[model samples]
Target: MKQSNFTTWFKSGSPWVWMNAGAVAIAVIMTLGLLILIAVRGLSHFWPADIVEAEYTIPGQPAITLLGEVTTREQVPTERLQGAGLPVDPEQNEFMDRELLKVGNRDLYGADFRWIVADWLSNERYPEDVIAIERREWGNFYGYLLSVSHDGEVVAEGEQAIDALQAAVERASGIYDEIHSLETGAIGKINTELERLRLRERGYELDNALTADRQAELEAERAVQNARYAELESELVDLYREFNRDSIMTRAMDGQEKRISLSAIVRVFQPNAMGITDKIGHYFAKLWEFVSDEPREANTEGGVFPAIFGTVLMVLLMSIIVTPFGVLAAVYLREYAKQGFVTRTIRIAVNNLAGVPSIVYGVFGLGFFIYFLGGNIDQLFFREALPSPTLGTGGMLWASLTLALLTVPVVIVATEEGLTRIPRSLREGSLALGATKAETLWKVILPMSSPAMMTGLILAVARAAGEVAPLMLVGVVKLAPTLPLNANYPYLHLDQKFMHLGFHIYDVGFQSPNVEAARPLVYATALLLVGVIASLNFAAVAIRNHLREKYKALEN
Candidate 1:
């Protein structure tokens, strides 16, 4: 039997199909690999590794005892090590291995890490008594607990000191938490109330409504608030004294004894003595701290809750602003407008906007939104806070609006495509039933196309959540002292600058003075950003799927 052309083509299979499949496989593999790498590097940071005590010696220097966790190890060329001003043996192998030890005693040694050649280390020991102290100010401290004290007098010594120290820390931490709540909650509320009253009084003056009765009422309220504040202040003073009452003595690797106040320590644990279960518990505790606590030590230590909160809030605000605007524009273009040269031009422009570089949007947002629009707003409404700039500067509001504008094209294109996919028969059927165009669009057409609209929103959110450059130019800061949303009136402070995880990664990776310390945090933060974006995308996908299922019968 002779082979026909159709048989030959079918036997060979489709080149385009094979090529696309290969491309997709490669992309999937790359994405999975990247995510795995980020997860390993980031999540491993919380594990409490065993601490090593080693005696290190150099060719010309005396031996010194080093105590720390071995963070990393790498092979280096002997010539490179020599070039870096380290002593290396030329007679030995061409390559030399070195270990990076996190010998944290920043306040004592002035450095948190040190690199030593593998050949120079000896007598490595993992002592059960070796303690790692995570502090509030200085970095981690590796030492031995010598004694527990109160008011400059020793109360417990030896192993008993450890128990005493833990108990005291627990009590002091409770006191600290109470103090923080009083200061930032109750006291903060009073301050916010005072500020609101001041602003209201100013507004009254501006409106020429500061009547004598109103003035008396304001004064009486102020007096009551002042009296309450004085009572809180007295309580705060007592709490502070209680927090500072206990202290502990520690001996460093070099036998240098020092007294560390309990208030300075956040957590103390002997990692070398921990079993699998204890290590697991400690890991969870550390992870919780990373996600809930405020960053300390120039953002090299502590948690990233602020950055996470800001990124989510900004993305949500952007979504709210973009969805309506995008839907209206897409609806007009695809359904209401005449399909002519002008409409085509507008559609072309919208598509082109999506291709514009993100930084260009950032620059435009800075110039037009901040300088022009924001400046006008501040001048007209906030003259009392003039020279300080109020809304005349970059803020969360401008950042959200800027991102909405940047991502609107994506939403428009997706929604238009969705609207285009609806059958003409459906539109005709609704119109034939005596429905007007507007009523048909609102009641019938829009409901069927909701899945597509959600698809656009999903794309917009994916892009906006990962955006750092535009956010930086508009409002993102390295550290925000307060979150944008709080318990105060109006609740959301749109005019405040805020932190973002994407920008946090950038700052911690590039802008930080401590590269070694911040590198792991970069991976951790990048992983977090990916998870956040994925979570948001997944939610949108679920909604779209639900809408698709609901409207499938209508399409048929």
Candidate 2:
């Protein structure tokens, strides 16, 4: 009787329903758990962790002074520690506490991080005067301030040293900012103009139209550009001199004294002395810099603004190119094409294309769009830039076009589904009112299908924004400091390579020289990429919902 009751429940589908619900619940829990883990590990990278100084000892070695921020803690098997040639007493405990410390001053030690056995550490202390210095290069420096100097003379020391050092840093930083502005701004403009002039001259020379007077005119323009460049160069020299006029002396954990030029230092803060409010403020400041500044230190440091900008721009360009073409194709397939085997075969092919590997699309883009089509265009219009392959190279324009092609099938399928959903009575009613089929499609059919088109776009963007494989071949680069859009004429430079968050994460996570340093950043960049894609999809979904509501009456 009990067995029969169990069989009855299974046959009634109750057990199946319960199983499905359990699967769904488990999936949701796993997804949320992963996201939470990523958030905690990634976002904490920028927090102001208190610096700890301790005396580290081993069973057979003398103690060494260690100063660093505690990055992470974990438990290791005692056997694993002993296997690594560490003296671990397996009898004491089966597991051992292991801690990772970010010991800075890479120039001195040649390593930024070290894993130490926690059981051997003693005399842990947090000193208020110990400062952490963020530098433009060589990672970071952790030490105590010794003195401040101007040029080669000691200008401030003792009690007034920190205050004097801060003032000097501010001055040096201001000069550095000016020098940066000159390099990327004014000097950059000059470089662009020079390239344009050279290209123009090359075109004229290639066409055999370079008369003596024309040659002289080009030479005169070149001379003027050179003069401007010289003036800027002289100004830059002065700025560099002032920028390097100050320096700070510091004492490291090993009691070794080092002098760091203020020009190379980005910021100095005593993290252990910082209050809660100060740490919070510092965290936000670091976060903002990560979002707003250009990358530095081999794409590991600074902000990813360029990647964010390029990803958005490429997606926008793809949307603009794909929408009209996909809609027209869908219109032809569903409304104009005859309901025969040919149309059926074409629809089958389109659906199959959607499942093709993304890397395959990347290869297609590289071969056809860049090598064949782009090379031909460069040959026809940019003959003077031959061999240089201006348009023939992988660039943002080709990347956008490649993505448009890859996603157009999705749009076609979506729009076709939307077209099929519209009632035939609506078309008949429009025709009865003397409207042509074209007019009916434009005014009635297309409006009702608008939501589906947006759905296609959202899907396309969601997939494309996180795509690293295709973009690596087409346009995305490991580093692209200069943005595509600028104040220069022909404002948008589509032929230039750009950065993407997806590729940035791959490069940081897999190719970085610093493993531990890049781990948290891998999480952070992954989170940022997800956020960016989500933001784009959310906007599209909102539009889709609005369109659906607006066309509800027509659909009914």
Candidate 3:
């Protein structure tokens, strides 16, 4: 039959193909753009930005010099500036350009950020002598190194002070590491052992078997731990004394001098003078520190190692729980059950469960997992730890279980689809070879469906990792005193609370006292969370691909 040009094009399907491809390309671009924005905002926070020294003048106010990094710049209406108590030139223009300076002498200025109209800034300079100091507390300090002192005596000055201060800082950092290890390692170990002994004594009391011999043994072990702790305490004291012996004197841009103890300093660098290579090295170092070190300064600064660890641990726990149960349910429904009304109703319920609000699951988790199941567990196994509510509290175990329940529907549906695809010939052939239905399902059907199982798992991991509301109610906390996994007895303590990267980002973005300082950290944390979830999914994808390849011949 003869056709018009439009009819011919429609029949070719080329237009639809092009439209689909364009839609996919746009989606890819948007996703990449978002990731690039996050990377730029978060990763740049680690780079040592050149510190600028500038003289700022405002009407009827004395000219003041400023030193620090230019953190933000934008244009604002002249009226807005006037409303904010800044003198604005009305005759000049409707809008005024402004810069926010991270003037890091927080101890002196009472704030880290300051805004000044760009027009009033003069004598802008990046001096090679200017140094930026990252302290253990009170944030950063930007100035010139005037001298390095030891025991209240000037040991080096001017150019020579840089080398001396670097050496002293290195030594102090080593001492700090030792002290940290002693506190969180040796002492932490001793404390865990002491706690175990206490719990053990309690257990014996509950059993009415508190024998004198057992008590004496525990006391003897505790005495040894005490002696070790005493020795470590003495060593820590010596380290602190050594660490505090050296300090640096720096001159602010306003010619004010301040002494900062070397022990309080985390790092010092000449950002204005740093070459590209130096900045790159410093950037990677800072990035590593952000991921490896424990958070400090109310979690607005430092690394989020605990959060990362907790997230991976909880997801792994959830995966372990959800996989078998999901597979079993799918097998029962798809393979064994008769096609009937009850089965159809059950399938509809499972599908509906997937659409339920996540916060509802959280409420269910708090009530059932924490209150009912946990209460019973505490009564049965941890009666001595009552009043304190050991297992009957929000914790990693309940959180993992709650997420498992939330994600099980996805896994069940995926597995059922896989089961239905395994040509009836294969199952019948297995049974024809003297195998029972259960045997054929176990060794044949399940192996062929492994790829689909992994697909479901990947989806579950992605969803569970990003879920914050449910975890907040079940287990996640602002800060966890100890990680779920540690070097203590029963290394994996599922009963303990844990930190999550999602919660960290939310808290730092909204709940932080220092909003300006925490803003960069929020972007960095969000990037890290995305990277973690991607890595997990990639691993699952690899396994899925391998399973698909292995089972391809069987299907054929």
Task: Judging by TM-score, tell me the better candidate of 1 and 2.
Answer: 2
TM-score of 2: 0.97
Taking the tens digit of each residue's C-alpha lDDT, what string does model 1 give over 1-556?
3568767776787766888999999999999999999999898989999999999999799999999999899998899889888878666879988999998888898888898898899999999998999998778999999999898889999979888888998898899899888988889989988876787687678789999999999989888889999999999999998888889889899898888999898899999889999999999998888888878888989999999999999999999999999999999998879999999999999999999999999999999999999999988998656667878788999999999999999999999989999999999999999999999999999999999999999999999999999888999999998889998777899999999999999999999877888989999999989989999999999999999999999999
lDDT tens readout by residue for model 2, 442-486 = 999999999999988888888878788999899899998688888
- Candidate 3 residue-wise lDDT, 1-556, digit = tens: 4568779989899999999999999999999999999999998999898998888899889999988888899998998988888877666889989998899888877888888899999999999989998898888998899999899999999889888888888888999999988888888998888877888889899999999999999899989988998998898889889989998889887899999999989999998778999999999999999999889878877899999999999999999999999999999999889989999999999999999998999999999999999999999988777778887899999999999999999999998998988999999899999999889988999999999999899989999999999998999998887789988778899999999999999999999988899999999999999999999999999999999999999999
Would you list the C-alpha lDDT of every candidate in the order shown?
A: 0.91, 0.91, 0.91
Off by over 4 Å in 3: 1-3, 7-17, 206-208
**Model 2 poorest 10 in a row by lDDT:** 294-303
Please identify model 2 stretches exceeding 4 Å from their true place: 1-12
